[model samples]
Target: MPTSPTTVLIVGSGPTGLTLAIELARRAVDVRIIDKTPGFPRSSRAKGPNPRSLEVLEDLGVVGEVLAASSAPLPMRKYRNGVPIADAAPFADARPTPDAPYDRPRMIAQWRLEEILRARLAEYGVRVELGSELVGLAEGRTSVTAALAGGGEIEARYVAGCDGGHSAVRKLLGVPFEGKTDETQMMVCGDVEAEGPDRGFWHQWFDEDGAVMLCPIPGTRSGWWFQAGPETDASGAPVPPSLDSFRRLFAKHTRLPGSGLSDATLLSTYRVNERLAERYRVGRVFLAGDAAHVHSIAGGLGMNTGIQDAYNLGWKLARVASGRADPALLDTYEEERLPIAADALDLSAERLRATMEAIRKPGGGLDSAVSERTNGLGGGYRRSSLATGGGTGRLRAGDRAPDAPCRDLATGTPRRLFEAFAGPHFTLLGFGPGTAQALREAAGAHDGELRAYGVDVGGPHGLADDGGHARTAYGIGPDEDLLVLVRPDNHVALIIPPGDLGAVGAYLNGAALERA
Candidate 1:
């Protein structure tokens, strides 16, 4: 039987799926999310959100709660022969700046992050339909019909497969998940209680025989993430991950007593894999997160990249699915995100190799590979179809729109550019008082779809860049008249020249987002 149609049918209820659901739900789009499992996964698989993902969370209004429930990345404490050898903080150099608020990656479990996103979606009167697995997909030019494993089928204007690397949707679509998996390198991981290692640092024990790492899981005093190589029996067969196996690995590598381990759960074996889908979009159906790409967990990017994939695709989907923009707007999702996924795959592979090499030494835990690149702040969509403008300024169209502390000229209260850019509307910021007339005119013209703010040196309305923080962060000068049109996803969509009202109208009208 055919169910009622939805604007978007999102398969898989992981971080990417949850984030996409919230993004569409908050926009009032008819989005439905589903998962194959009957219950939520309790495994604290992915460690945390990276800096860029945190920025996205802030926009989605969940960053505060996430930070409240999370902790900072722990410093790695390397030990040799049960003796502390060295200590290093890989994220020490990451500091918040005016342009970027989330400088450091925040450590929260992936399952918890998904729960938070689900709550946010619930705020919009939406909930994930768990156990409603997609068993088949029939893609058409304008819509898709997804067959569920249960009984019925759901038809939607568009379908997004936010499912993981082993995505059934991808397989049915015949999308080649192209990459290599290193069978030689396998990691046995589990959630266990360890009383021996201090929770302040991520403890790593190394000996000529092997190595084992135990990192404290935030929000729990007794829980720690244990990872080690596979243990072989007398027959040289790999031992399965169990409480006994984890205890044995810890006792063999570290001087910690076997009694230190208890309540071992969420145990699984991991193989080093690097894979990316041949494409992100196929007709009206699309892929995001692990469905599009999967890589090593070295840089802790598996979840972060997936969250960003949803972030980039969310607004585009919302707009297109709502008829706010042309269907061509949907194409940019792959154009902008595919390259980043490829880059992240390579970076994760590189980081994994670097850490592996570093592990062969005495004072090597997280070495040069753990740099600012892993924070995921520098990525931008300069070459995307939705982005334009170049030549000058500190930033360009397609760059991540910067946030700045400013003053609201109306009430004389402090405000943030990010606060203004928090919703699902285009943000137009006009620099200096000279552009007030044009900004006010544009705001009146495009009242709801595009919000216009006057960032002035001394204007009576809109935002004021006190001490020039806004100007510096936006890379605008006091004299140079500029207008930046930031997309709902916080990417600069178009950089209009001074008083280019025609360009604004033309772009908005062409994109079919010209409301009010």
Candidate 2:
């Protein structure tokens, strides 16, 4: 078969692949994405998107649409013997604030999230090619040739494997996926309709046998996600999940009448398995999302982590393919994200164990600490290559840059500090007047690779007299002046004081600066 040429090719149309395509398209990179599935699945696997995931979606300009379609501040209800025991809306106080407005997870079904992402991708005039599966991969010095199931081939400067756990790309690369599958804990999951309960709260019932969890499926009438411990036969063989099986399990565990439940769809039995690829990239072929790592479903971080992986790689891939930066810049993708995946694996596994243990202890509720952290807000890349050190009272790199309302000197319109951090560009934020010249010089030196913005240190639009939200976000004192360099990923790349202009230039020119 003849090889079709493209700048970048991505396999799988899941959140990870679609996010990569959207990011690359926003940067005007010519890219194509292929998936084996004919269309999106209607089942709700991942219940919601976390705060960190929301930030990434916000950058794609689809957070508003997602928010509108999502249900948030979901009250977690615990029931015993078909009677409500405790009901607590954990994030009832959560509101959208400047630093981290998405204080709680938005309970939107994974299918609906994909729909919103597809709509955003459509805005860039790109559609996912369905029924095209990756069958083979051959790499050369400059490009990768991928064989398609459609009896064709595609040649692209780079290929990313966003395909799920049983990734053919990972298999083709001959990398070892090391992990263990928990045979002890098996789950039967399906989407079903319940006539007796209102679709408002997520309910969990715990007893000596096991626990059954049910959460409302957002945007679906009478739809809910049902998960329960598996039932094994006399031979120890696992019973397959079906509508009848789900009905029976719910009736036995939660004591809810099974007759009221109907229309169970997409039933499947699964065992929680944790795994991570030994490597994220090999030559020109790369992996992201489930292809790279898989973990327990306790936190729902599996899909969110994959979305973040694509967000981190999208701009870097665009730059390298466009010949703007050195290909070595791609190495940082794994360096920054691999450890994060490792942390996520450990955290989720721990949460699963803790939740199980809690069920065994009397008067034990879900650990509030574990529940809050599992939401993905507390995860950070403090040890990434882009991070720099700081002492007490100093802003450090690798921390999320703070946002404050500021006026754009050019347009005289009020905007948040995050506005300057938008787009795939290096942003130099000046804390005072002197850094303006430094920013100008750096912009000239880096040319197309950097963008500079100046934030004055006076008045209502400037840093507050007492160093308020902006000060805390940027970690600057009211009297101190400095320049903060933010990467396209919205991470603080470097914090430069008055004398560090030259250092900033060298840093931008170094490998840390992504291509294009």
Candidate 3:
């Protein structure tokens, strides 16, 4: 509600908005974040961060806390007639690699993850403004004015609609959100305390009449995440989700007493609704997270995709907002994330169908949903305009910048490639000594925006690829002269011959600079 203009206005304080706010603030950009609710929701709603998201969290500097507070996904113990029949650990084989670390998803509650992000955001002297709802929005050529519920108005350079499903900002832009809702795939989910199952394994009881699943919440003693296949009447209409109905279904499916389940709060019903926005951007306003797309909850991709969307947009928004790059740089956010969301929609639906099929068979479980195969590691923007030169070397533009173990030339100690790429700056990893002068010159020309490092290159004190791991990971020979420009989000923005420094500058300039 301050009279001064904000650089970015983020609507919704969920994972999406929180991630964006942290990204912009860490870059020293002025950002304002708001949520409609008066207080933070405490529900253990979504499962937790996937493998790729853990990398994002590491970049954000909160993975240690997440790992301390969370646990790995537990094996699902299947039961028939209240007797244990099978144990399935789909993600057990997921392990860390030098290129892609943090192999599996953690099992923290959604509320706990948000709390950690909020604490990290506070380190930057910013806090979420709760109870502030957008009532009206006015957009102009280069700025947006958002009117809140309490007769307050805010002016921002850009408005990001991280608000979920029914987004007010998306509505103001009049963009169409298209998808289908399958009522037949209904579920009732909640957080509760039950006396039925051990805390080590996720318990699932299946019967001809009904089904119930109880998974222990990582940080709670008596608390468990409860999910149930909906109970139906003779006509097959789902009995509405309620306490008594949930109890009846649990008792009917399992041999455990109905009275054992208690404190069943934060209960809700969900139908499998798959939808994507027609477009992510409408002039000065952009939609992200569930605002831009919603998919079946299979594969645990719902919150993870939104977090990925925020990460992809955060660095671009910061660069453009800080005037280091052209606003056209922002267009690539949609170009990159929309296809990922569309593909995730299909992946989630396919996994959901497979899960349902498995539930009907003996020794069947949701292995496909929990596999690293469905994780977001394989996504990139190779086809975008920014990718050039046939993606030379083993690493190509539009591909993920792989990490490796190396030596700090200055200290003669072990270091990680990710350690150098940790902050909110573009990284240029140059191979061979001939590119050293250009790397240093480019770093000086861009000031602090671009950081340059020489790998296995001869200099007084340049980084040494002691094991040749960096060269192997980057797919470069010892004598090759390659310049790999890594975007702030750790994607290879441009992989060019060492002399093409102008190409790097032009890529950052974007169309916005030419128009100016």
Candidate 4:
């Protein structure tokens, strides 16, 4: 055991914790991350990363590695007695446009994704401190002292609980994790090598008795993920998961031969539960990922939501610890993320119920109605303190700022609007003439914190006119010449329609811009 001091200490080295570590470290914030597990697990639990998650990964500079290790969207097929009943490719129908690069989700194992994140964190000269369990915590006005299992201690200005379900940190804080545990919907999941199916697609078989699903594991020969509704024994206890038990269940449901499936690994039975912490923050201790929320595995939002939570909190924590922003900014972590978690809980529970109800019917198709809300691109904080001005037509405060190909003017080189928005600063995209001076003046006032770009009106270097794609993307109308201020998270904070430079300044400095 080793004692240490850090500005921010992250508990649990899962995706969320690792992400926060990388984000804070990128800003030169001293961060320490620890996990109870000695090493990364080799399980194929989470399906893959969503589009919005891809954006976050891109921000961390590891999107390329994740994409390279993942498989593209394959058609999901629902079957009856080994025959295809219904099939659909959600992403194929909703093809990705330039505006949204990852319109579809990728299929990759959770362990592989964690590996990529760990690698990225290594680039920052920080690695996960394994075998370090957080047993207790004490917080003061200025710092938090975390008690370790091996009698060591860490003093951190802030502590984040990225620990998964049944988080020790959450328990030590005495936060009520209120939710229901559905005992009836028990599921057995595992990674296995099987010969029964050559579907080359994710297959789900549902009938009167139960359901069995199989999805291919990317980059593994004859490897697949098996999930089946649980079967109770004579005493009504869930039959423990095993290769033999899985084969027997598959045989009973799909009439598939038991001999075809073999080499079972990482088998575990999970009960569907929906729970959320009463509060995200308790003094200097905070919660993220599964520590804050847990829900049904319907839309595969579990890991993605956690990653996004860390993304939302990382920069703010960095800003506050670095003395750039006041501690009041920390409150926004709960204000913005808690609502999203609540919504996710409702959505995941609904999706699980809908799927179960659909299975009860004779010819019910898969309920693809699971809200794409967790698609990363759709989540925003328009209600935060930073948002200003409400316009009916375009330029709303709560929209995802659009990206476009624009010239640097001085450099005469083609660059995307997102490229300019890449750094950790507030970006002002002005799309009208006679405002260059205003943009320059705002940039000068904020110095390095604010950057303004002036786009010529009715010029080729400006927005494309095809349906005002760029304007609509930025939430500004074709006729409206506006200055759109984008937050560091790529969300629109304020939209000034031509005549409100003073209002933008007020929004930035005043309470109009919340800490989150």
Candidate 5:
């Protein structure tokens, strides 16, 4: 029998699916999220979210909880043949800017992060329907029908597959996952309990034969993440990961007793796989996160990329589902994200090669792999069709709208551009007097779909740039008049003259986002 219909059916309850569910639920869009697993796993595969992902969490109203549950990235304690050699702090000099609050990624177990997202989703009256598995998908003229493993079907206006690398949805879509898997390069990883290493730093052991790395997991008394070169038997075949094998590997690399390591769980083998799906969508069904793409885990991009993917697709899905935008708006999902995924594959591959090389040398460790590029702040959609009109100074259409501190004119309270951009509505910022009329017109025209604010122009919706950070961040001169339209995802959709109301209208119309 078919169940009640939902606006969107999210397959998989990992970070990706949870994010999409939160996005939709917050917008009052009916959403159902399911996971094949009976319950949440205890695994902590991916370390944590990056800076960009943190921003997404902030908009979703759960960044404070995440901050409380996570730890700052620790320094790396390196060893050679089991003797401590060097200490490296990759993010020692990293600091947050006025516009970017997070300078580096936090260190938290993947399971903990997922728990936070799930809790946030619950606040919006949505819960992960565990034990429900998606076995098949059928797209109709207006909705998608998903077949569950247990003799049930769910109908939804859209379906997003955020399932992992071996995604059933991708297979059902018959989309080719085109990429190579380097079997030779592999790592055995697990959550473990160990007695010896200090928890202050991420400890790494290097030797002629292999290496073992262990980082203490946050929110756990003795939990640690263990990763190492695969253990092989006399036949040179990799030994299957287990408590015994994990203990043996730890003892062999760190020269610690096997008895010191215990309670090994979530054991798995990781091979270098770089795969991207041929298409992100087929009819009303779509793919996100690992279902859409998979990459090497070098740059810590796997989970963060998925979080960002959900963030990108969330608002667009909400608008289209609510009939506020044309169905064609959904096409931009693949157009913008596919290219970014390709670039991420290349970046992670390059980072992997470099880190592997660095680990081979004396007194070198994974800390050397950290850099600004891995911060995930530079990505933009400048080449995207959604990036319309001309740019001013350093910022242009499709770039992330940077945050700036200011004062709200009505209440004279301190506020930030991010605060204005927060929520499911598109934001329009008008700089100087010339933009005031356009701001008023745009607000009157779009109503609930858009929020218009005037910067440095005193009015009901005016914001005073006390520190001048807003103008500088947007690259506007002291006396200039500019109008910047930001998408629901915080990316600039257009930058035009203050009085060019036609440009704003054209962009809004062309984007097919007018409220019905």
Candidate 6:
């Protein structure tokens, strides 16, 4: 421990924990992340990051590595009675637009994604403390004291529980995890080296009894993800997942030779659990990711939801820890995320039922589970109290701020709106010429905390929108002179006229006690 207290103490080193650690570390917040595991596990629990998560990764400067290491979503080749019957590409029609650069999700191992995040965290001189498990927690009026498993204690200004669904922090706070676990719907999942399936398509074999899916793992020559309904014993107890058990299941379902599958690793039995924490925070301790909520894996929203949770809480924690914002601002975390979690649970449940029904039909695949809602672009904090001020055009307060192609006026270099929104500062976009004064005032008032860019204003910090993509993406008319204030997480916080510049200051003031 250092002479000064840690700013944030993050428990667990999964995607959620790693994400929060990076967020706080990039802001120069003294953050300490710990995981109970003795060493990092190469578990590919979640398939990959969704489109919205790609945006978050882009901000964290790791999307390039992820893209380089990942493969696009593959088409599913469905087989009936061990014979290939149908091939369906779920995201074949998906294409990137100026507003949304990533149209489809990539297929990368979860462990690999965590490795990338951990490497990025190291760049900030922060590393995950392995085998450091949190056993006890006591919150003071201003700080939290965490008890580690090995007879050591750490004091942090704030504590974030990024541990999985079985979060010790959430349990220590006595928060009720209210949900049901569907034991009847259990699947054995693992990573294996298989010889039968080609790496071109996600192969699925269906029969009257059940189905087994094998998806080729990106960045691996012979690796495949094995998933299927759990095998049962005579007494109806699920046989624990093992390499031999996985081979038996594969042979039973796919009619492939048992010797074709070997080197099975990261085996686990997954029971469909849909649970949400009763509360996200108690005093200075907060829960995020699976610590706050867990959902069905049908829509692949479980990990993405957790990542977004860390994204939402990271800046608020940093601000409050630095005294840049009032402690009350932290309450908005639960207010906005709880509803989103509830919605995700319902959506996943619905998708699970629909997918199960679709699987019963011949040549039916998981393609029935794909929809616009699963893309991760439509989620926003529209009802959040932070979303104030009236909307302009088709865009509204609390909507995700869309990106567009633009150019840096000063250097004549090409740039995108995402580049402007990157980093740990608020972004204020002035749509037209009338917003020049507003942009100047905002920049002058909040120098380091905010970045104000004028689109077509022909002034300092003006962006040259030669293609008019900026205006079209933001839904602003050619002559429209509205200002859109974006939060650190890239959500539109406010949309107001240039003359109502006072509202911007008022909103910021109301959210925090004072500007540091």
Off by over 4 Å in 1: 367-369, 457-461, 511-516
- Given candidate 4, what's the lDDT at residue 291? 97
User: Residues 179-270, candidate 4, lDDT per residue (tens digit)?
Assistant: 99988778999998887576577777887778888888987879999999887799978889999889888888777787789899999989
State each candidate's clash count.
Answer: 0, 5, 0, 6, 0, 0
What tens digits encode model 3's per-residue C-alpha lDDT throughout 209-303?
Answer: 56898889888888888889897889988887777777888888777778888888888988889999999998888999999999988899989
lDDT tens per residue, model 5, 1-516: 568898899999999999999999999999999999998997699999899999999999999999999999999999998899999998899888878989999989989999999989999999999999889888888888999997899999899999999999999999999999999899999999988689998999988789999999999989999999999999999999998988888899888898988989999999999999999999888899999888888889998889999999999899878887678888889888998888889999988888889888978888766778888888898887788668988899889999999999999899999999999999999999888888999999989889999999778989999999999899999999999999999999888887677777777666423311
lDDT of 6 at 239: 93
Q: Model 2 off-target regions past 4 Å?
A: 93-97, 234-236, 361-370, 388-394, 408-413, 444-448, 457-467, 511-516
Comparison by TM-score, 1 against 2, better one: 1
**Model 1, poorest ten-residue lDDT window?**
507-516
Candidate 4 clashes: the total is 6
Q: Compare candidates 2 and 3 on TM-score and give the better one.
A: 3
> Could you tell me the lDDT of residue 220 within candidate 4?
82
Residue 497's C-alpha lDDT in candidate 4?
Answer: 63
Cα RMSDs, all models: 2.4, 2.8, 2.1, 2.7, 1.9, 2.0
**Which ranges of candidate 4 are over 4 A from the true structure?**
362-371, 390-392, 407-414, 457-468, 497-499, 513-516
Cα RMSD, model 1: 2.4
